[model samples]
Target: MKRITTLAGTLAFALTVGFTPVTLIQAQNKGRTEISVKELPKISSNSILGSFNADFSGHNVSSDFLINHLGEWLGTGSDHTYKLLKQNKDELGIKHSVYDHYYKGVKVMDDMILLHEKNGKLTYVNGEIITDINLSPNQQPTSQRIRSIIISDLKPQGKLTISNIEEVITKVSNGRKAVLYHASKVEALSMKPLKAFTYYIDNASGTVVKKNSRMHDADTPSTSTTYYKGDQSITVDSYNGEFRLKDNARNIHTMNGTNLDVDTINGGIINVEEYISPVANYTAVDTKPAVEVHWGMKNAYDYYMTRHNRNSYDGNGAKIDNYYNFDFGGFTGGANAAALDTPLYGGIVCMLYGNGTLFGGLLTLMNPVVGIDVAGHEYSHLIIGRNGLGGLNYESESGAINESIADMLGTAIEFYSGSSPNWTIGEGIPTASFLNPSPSPYMRSMSDPNNVNPGPQPDTYNGTYWASTANPDADNDHGGVHTNSGVGNYWFYLLSQGGSGTNDIGNPFNVTGITIEKAEKIIYRALTNYMTPNTTYMDAYNFTKQAVTDLYGASGNEQQQNVKAWYAVGIGNGILATSEAVRNQDHFNIYPNPVKEGVLTIENDKNNVSVEMYDASGRLIKGAQKLNKGTNKIYINNVQKGIYLLKVTSEGSGISTKKIIVE
Candidate 1:
């Protein structure tokens, strides 16, 4: 039964993708200024020009350009070019040519300026119409560089602030030159010294770029620490140093220091007191928050890298920045305020923890699992932002699918960490008790829908169904992504747990009964390889089935089970009839469950048994022989590694049957 259902679902999904046209939705248009591709100068071998070209082609570009192009194609004044140079100016030591041309007494090339329009207007490389060109006389170089000026103001409390600001002067053959200043600085500030100053001093001119006077002393190191039985203790010289807790004999049990802390004497008991510190002032020079925030961020990063082998949110090793006390006032729902990835930080991933109200709310949700699933869930949103999964909140199936993907991956992460098989979302958040009428099973329940009040179930009697509506702006809560996701979430749970059997709803399904380990393997492959950014539930259904087939042959039960699960969740098989009458009347028949040599007994009721053998995608590969009634055997000797469907048809009877594999 599982094999039949899987074969049918796989075939239907293939048909859907083969025939459906995937539409690419356009994101918001930020701003647009057209550039004539012809106006850009071609690359040449002149040493200076070659060097400039090489710099442009190589690493001397801005991050914005790198983001768009990664140097895939070269064109001047494109976002790619602007971003690449903007990002790497310090490394490449290139000056902003536009700023240099305007502020410094530098001659501009004619190629840099172009006549626009039949209107005879002048324009720069990016088609910005220039009414006039003004070149100011070279001003006397100031003793205070921008970097130095900013860093000088920074007050280093306990740690020193080091600024590596570079100033470059580029001169052309005609003595036309420009001075470019690039700044990079790291401030080491300690929170212990109340009057300590952390400042950024530009290395080039020795001026402060930024400074803050409101500095707080770092936490005092713990003294008189004692070790209890089996609890090892180490007296570190500094509070900000790394310390690993060991057993009675000093065998390291766990590493904790500076960023991480525990409450109890032993490693098993974590101290919550260490987490209770006032939020750090964003404007303060010694702008370090209490240790807990650091620990959370570090844990989040480690979760992705260690558990899933994922470097960062985008699966690329993008650097992540931490933002403390992100204000979303009056929204107190979870622990340590919520942390999420934001795009504003130069596509540099960020996790922001709110003050007590919001931050606490987030932490409340995160406490259930110490591993990366929850962190991975939030981080996946960051990837969604970069890849363009519409607004975080919306009313469409898209939003639900988005949330489901997060939940799915989160569960995968938990499973990766060797955690138990549980299908509860936000198990740590306490607010669900107040918000949801039915508590305990805070979110969706996979195995028992009754656990959560008003859980997901098919509205068969009312004729309402899943994926029936196309409204994308529906925000039950941010479009009810959390709410509607139950459909898909439950579907996964049923698929994972129910295994090749009829679900509670009495729908035919194939439970592969494979371990979660195998399921994770199949799902990860499907998500990375088969799915698109805008993938819908149907796409997921199709993609995952194919993915399973690819990984474990077409006739494989693993693939079949995935198909049966989707069907049980009320997603109609486009090819299979929902009516029992039609299914019973159909005339397809294939015998010998464990047949060898690929020889199967075919019993076609009608004289017109037209056998069509299809490979997963519903693509008909060959026609089967018309078999006579009782016991006519057909040789499927050359059948490939997959479950094939034998569609036998008579005048008024049509039935699709499943064929299995021996090899």
Candidate 2:
């Protein structure tokens, strides 16, 4: 699975705004003045923001105009000001402008909105905004009692170090409620510094409002190989007519890592030997594994830059320094790779690839250097860390999501860097590890996560082999960050490559694959734009559905597939795209959308259905019709020109609903 035309020129939230279920709120008719069907704004909405498809044939407005008229649009108070955060333009020429909510000159952390534009017209506005912040930051300091109580509670065994403490307001209940809290990070000094947490102490009640993980670690199994990838080319620094395993172009350094303390290797500067050769040809036996890591990192970098347009993992071309032959003792075994902060040694953040003990030389013991996926996976963890894909600690469901995302991206990069039909993570590692020794023993399988070689993972959420989220970190692979990852890993596979099976819920399902090219973009967008820390599997459903709607369109194939794929993974019910009376499909087609003659044709594939039409203000129109199993045409007489919602209820159950222009 090694084919490089590019590295070697291979293939190339809210006021507080934590994740919550996205609720659909129908526009409640407050001021009901009927407008013509031709005059109705082409609209869309989530619980927070709305979308408008406008034609700037005559007039155009700039992003500055949107920022200036923020209050007029979202009904924010005069005390609120929107500070421009950043603007980005994709290859499709769509411009995205982000603005954060500022109340009385203070930034409300997660409360921000994103505007999508094409040419000049605003296409969509999203993200929650915080308003009516009555509590001033200068109001009061946290009481001593509360601080003492918090410190006592946190430091049970070790010294509790509280840092990065500040006051901020966060909103919940869909941004309808707000609370002020003294937010600070607390870590037990005597414990592994790896586990640090951020706490939001309620300023009023002094209760621990929330605790989130600040530790983002790529501590898991994934590997690449010089053993499998065969001979390859890598960029080496040319110095004194010698070549060193230091890629100046990509800013990557690969160290020998012969004998380093695994405990303190994560941090501190070290003067280690870089794998080098007197001449350009490095055929030394010792340099082979180092070549694997150096080559893998460059490819992973190219994969992100080439596909997603990210310059590097941090999107700022962050230098990547790595150490091969890293020794992860304590049964973690061979092939353990992690994005650890190398201390005085490199004084830079480095990804450590373990030099595993070759168990009988026929199997590699544990994690690291399993192949391109390891590099891609660890690199993805860095991206997830930067993007907050998995919040708080890298454990439980959040951690599972974090790992799953890495697996997906890793597999994608594996497919990208080379050619492979087997979408398995560590498949390229030549010698099968003992943990899951088989004909092809890879770490994780996106195509079939249930492949019980390395570990039996869940394909559907809460399905067979589902890891207990409540399990302690010391026990269950950090609450099955590696196990429960199968749900999302399988979801990505089904989303990309189409599959049919009954989920654990016993719901038989079938989804049309949107292909990896499109599917990857959807995942990328949802993870980067919509998802927040602490987003659940169900919350991911909403975010991804919105992502599908944003990238493609509502009621389209991508949306349908996205929902069904998640459903197959046991997240939400699969949605069927219904007719709009003017809805276009192969079996159904009605001429111009706003039924000109007021005659609406209904198609009932399910049980007998009832149709109800509502105006923009949620006011039901005068007419309601009952249609049979076949197609029925009904004449509309009382309906006037306005945007109406056509609710199709099948038998006694409601399938789905949307708005339409009924003339």
Candidate 3:
């Protein structure tokens, strides 16, 4: 760490010396910033969930609280600090102070924390940061290098124009923990597959850092000018005697995407035009797709709320805004659909659906604006983004897992809200650009991932046709995010429907499908509770098994099936998660506090534990039972509706007595 007495002094020296493009005042001028990493609450050695419960209370606590409590962990004199990026207040009135990590006064790539607050107390947080950095102040991108990047990456005459560019500390994986300065730019490409690209260039070496496609898509499989659902009732808001395609009750609004930049193409633009019709029914031949988008989002919202107990994507009933028929480089639509948070704005999220891309004046790629499952898929991205499982860059194995999750959840929604003959993504939007396997006109297959046409869809981890993340870029679909997702997609399928097959690694296994209801619950629980931003396919295997242990007994049939499914998908035989291998043995979690449900889940890593339930009057309602090692489920159906105390004891791990309600 540099020996600087004040932040102002450091900035003045750096500026006067003409070294480093860091402006300390610029970060402070941003709204409510600087709650960054110093030290996160510690976890036990055998912990399953890398989470902590801190004792702190405040309504609008400043960063000083962190600096005071966490010592140097909150910067103080460290080389790294955090900048407030997004401020989100959900319907439940919980404030999610989203912060991005900055080191030496510049933003680091993919390092952020979502500090959650509710009822004047810090509740939860999830995010990660790279620690190893070696770039010096003088090594920052020079003005000449910036101009060179502009000329080489995007020429002034080129169609792709830069939206925003900045120097970022990119972590390089492999032998050691290190970082390199990269010029990151978000640019919109004009022709072919018209859309935006976020590419990075090594500032010193002048090599490409990597290009990631920021396509957080949620879409439907409807055909051109044809509604997939075929005439469904929709809600509309009326103002000035004109009916608009805005569902005030659900807070959903649809917009037309025409003559717009990459930012405007992806909704969240407050002043953008909303779809309006003079009549209550929006049946105009040209503007009918808006109807489908509105309806699809409604179902997506209702499904998450009703099925998962999540209020909306963020568990706070955030409004859903969507845009369809986005104009891309003179094309009516691009070739993708995405869930996006505007880079320039905080807490503003939107969905974008594009049509076929143009090929030499002919639109060749096709993406329909309506499909319930596709909409659910897109909504799943928003859900992932909010639930601490967000910030998974759409690249490498993390990106693959992220994509696969949406596929499974979206398919689950398809079963919940409508009918589906098959588990094919975008089955309604057949396109020549992306050729599906013969006789199947769709985007992807959860059931038979290997049967995809014209592309690699590996049902086993890193088996065949898997995209390598060695040097991820856009051409390889960001380390085969779409292609490698087949592995997880198959895992979910086998978990849903019983299957028997030999994996690519020559491992033969048979899995008993837990059914979609149970499987979806496990997926949701693992994702929201256990997953972090950079979770790998291998990590998913353990987390999901832990989710199973939480739902069922620690070693129930579901656990066995989970093992078999992963084996069948080439994720190895599975891990036992013994005390020796796992960490954070001190912490445990209990869920569904109201006890309205029949069962309550307890997650811990201690051994020789015991649980007891007592009534409000101190009378023992349930006798003490010897708890298992991993997870335990206690049934409350026998207990009467009243307030009760639940006590759990573990040798050397301490005892916990919590007040639980049974209804």
lDDT winner:
3
TM-score to true structure, per model: 0.41, 0.65, 0.65
Clashes of 2: 33
> What is the Cα-based lDDT of residue 373 in candidate 2?
77
Q: Which stretches of candidate 1 lie over 4 Å from their true place?
A: 1-309, 321-327, 330-342, 352-372, 383-395, 419-421, 431-438, 453-475, 499-510, 572-663
Native-vs-model 2 lDDT?
0.59
Candidate 2, which ten residues in sequence have the lowest lDDT sum? 3-12
lDDT of each: 0.36, 0.59, 0.61
Better of 2 and 3 by lDDT: 3
lDDT head-to-head 1 vs 2, winner: 2
Question: Candidate 2: where are CA atoms >4 Å away?
Answer: 1-82, 101-111, 119-125, 128-180, 186-225, 257-268, 328-335, 341-348, 357-364, 387-398, 419-421, 428-440, 468-479, 546-556, 576-663
lDDT of 1 by residue, 532-602 (tens): 32344565565565456445544445655666667766565523211111111133334443344577666
For model 2, how does the per-residue alpha-carbon lDDT over 485-531 read when each residue is reduced to its tens digit? 89998889889999998988798989889988888888887777655
For candidate 3, write residues 513-589 as lDDT tens digits: 98988889888877876566666776677668656655663445676778788988987565432211111223555
Ranking by TM-score: 2, 3, 1
Model 1 TM-score, 2 decimals: 0.41
Say which prediction, candidate 1 or candidate 3, comes out ahead on lDDT. 3
